[model samples]
Target: MLNRRHIRVKVMQSLYANLGGESEDFSKDQKFLMQSIYSMYDLYILLISIFIEVRNKGIDQIGKQKQKHLATKEDKNPNTKFVNNEILKFMGDNELILEKIKQQETIDWDLDSEYIDIIFKAIVSSNAYKSYMKTRMSNFQQDKEFITTVFREVIAPNDKLYDYIEDKNLTWLDDLPTINTTILKLLQKLRPNPTKTYLLPELYRDEDDLKFATDLFTKTLLNQNELNEEIKHKTINWDSERLASIDLVLIQMAICELKHFPSIPVKVTINEYLEIAKEYSTPKSSNFINGILDKLVKEYEADGKLNKVGRGLL
Candidate 1:
């Protein structure tokens, strides 16, 4: 399911595509966004699949090496040690992940397979692995480092992968780093912090509900009669079709959040979209969206139509 971060990423992608010359074809951008959003889930599955692939590759490599010659005391082969000790153990311990990957057939074979291969190769070829080997030789340690290294070195470098990942995933990329520095900071944050609890069940459930709610909000906002050419003409000075199109779409999305997602505090919705506007629209887009949302929120509040739940939601 889509999360706030995922929504942000989708908005960013759509904005990029729009600004990159897909403005005349909103449907194309919409389809691309939708596909990107849906692909996030698939990306996770593909990652697990790739992990297994790497494990298998390691096993094969070890078998071949073992068939050729045994390790000597004078000449320590790091690659053989890596395969026999670290990789094989990881594969054995992570049977559940392996099972999940095996049970599923990739929906987008090209994207999934190619992405996995790229990530796997990147991990095996990274400086992190070399650094890790200098300090530690345990398979468990190597596996941990490998996962982190791939995310850091490989996955982060490829913007195209993010597009594929966004298409597969429903949520969780919105707040992620757009730059390498931010990503490193994030990776540091995701370190096995002791305070973190295993709340996968709750997280998954919330994600599902949010996805449904977001879809509903999008549909309702698009269907609103108030968001018409008349409203655009009155609210915005842009007479150009391209500018107007982007403005109208953003305004509609913001309005949808204001009306449909009551628990999402009005200010948060406004702020989120304002940030999005700055990245997606004209330089003055943040101000423009801010003004419109502010006006609309006041109007909705005055009409007693702001039916939000929970404390501090207003």
Candidate 2:
């Protein structure tokens, strides 16, 4: 679920934290970086668990309606299609997911049942849910579509839910977009019957990615003096007022990749930081960082220091 860019963002975040005066210990900062990366997976688990919790609530609602003293015909025979959705059922029953959540030892719905209830109410009231249950069909594909639609439309954009999540863990606000996309992509690719036990997302793409986060964070921290010299020589009278903290962090990471990481192409490293700056930095940050990086890359090449290997590497 996490790509190289996401890992880059994690490194950038760790670098910012290190430079933020929050902690001065490099080893502690490295541990924080690893935990932060794992937190993304934890957030993903918490979110996908929402569908299962809401589905359970939906089933409880049907049961309660049936036991009512003055139950109407509609109440007595509530549509179970949404509650009995196969995809949701699978997710709810999947041992892999169950064990993962158990390991995390968190279920936000338990603490905030009202949030799940609110989301359920929104789902049933939605045109998508109404149309889904209007027809008495419940195939795997239809079930998948309805659950995905509810998540896409109701659960993800829900203000109360968002506030609840943000309050639970502040970093979740950053992890939200990635977690939402991960859930949707996993939902999209789910087959009716899978050969494996579950098509779960791996925390790290590979061991190398796991190492990349630590390496990037540590390298940038250790080489701060050298990187500062590089930026200082380029920018006259540069300080906190002139450069956004995030833009400065991004540039440092880019410089680290260029000088320390040999296999990475110069263009790829520059483009990655530029994109990150555009999103996480100021309006003019992309162009500003781009200009500084352009000058630095030229200098590195001229000094025979930016000796990048690989076919496409510059």
Candidate 3:
């Protein structure tokens, strides 16, 4: 569930916050950043729940309208058949999203009103809805068919619209890093030995390695700038004030692992950071990060600074 890009996004948010705020406290900033990274799942669930609420509201509106009036020939009320049966019912039965909602206690479903509205509008305007309407107009003779078509085409795609809304929604996530940290802390406390008892055996083997990577990453972000002159020198070339804090943290993490983690391959570190940069930074950030890391790796190798071990690591 937690990908490199997600992690980088979290880091970037934290960095941005720290830069904006006048506080010089790195510890506070670090805590804020990590927390945000951890809460991405919760944010996703919140967005989906909002979508569900909007879909339900739309269906309810249509149902109420149908109950109040008898359908005329031209009035072909497709809402009664499609809205209730196809759209609302499917949202109710979606176990994955429902389970996520059930697990979340802090998120208020009512708070998603604006987000829902945007998603609903986007769904109605989508190409999918037009296609459904056209198909229904051609093939189905009954009013019920028209309703079903609208429900299937317009309301069903609300889920997709929710995704679009989420991908574009950033202003609401101003405190995202802080929220993520709180959720992750809760999850960790709830299942401390998850890898030992719940994780698959294959996954357990690399648990330590993954932890090492994450820990190294965390440490580098938290301490490397203050401790390493080489890092400071490289950072001098970039606009530290304007740089996305998340990108800075992720780059530091990647560099730390590249030089310090002997068992991990250079390609893995570079690839991981590149993927992360794409998600958390500006569109051009991945290319920029990739170039810098590539140069750093070559410089490290030429200076006989890299001391990697293990079969696949180079």
- The model with the greatest lDDT is 2
Q: For each candidate, give its TM-score against the true structure.
A: 0.64, 0.94, 0.57
Q: How far is candidate 3 from the true structure (C-alpha RMSD, Å)?
A: 9.5
Q: For residue 252, give model 2's deviation from the true position in Å.
A: 1.0
Clash totals for all candidate models: 16, 0, 8
User: What lDDT tens digits, residue by residue, belong to model 3 across residues 88-150?
Assistant: 344456675577678876466466456566656755676654544443333223333433444
Tell me how candidate 3 scores on lDDT.
0.55
Q: After superposing candidate 1 on the true structure, give the runs of residues whose Cα lies further than 4 Å from its correct spot.
A: 8-38, 69-81, 84-95, 107-121, 139-146, 158-208, 211-222, 233-244, 302-304
Error of 3 at 168 (Å): 12
Q: Write the per-residue lDDT of candidate 1 for residues 18-95, one digit (tens) a residue.
A: 442212334565676666555454445454344456556666655665566665643344355444444334444565
Best model per TM-score: 2
Q: What does the lDDT read for residue 291 in candidate 2? A: 87
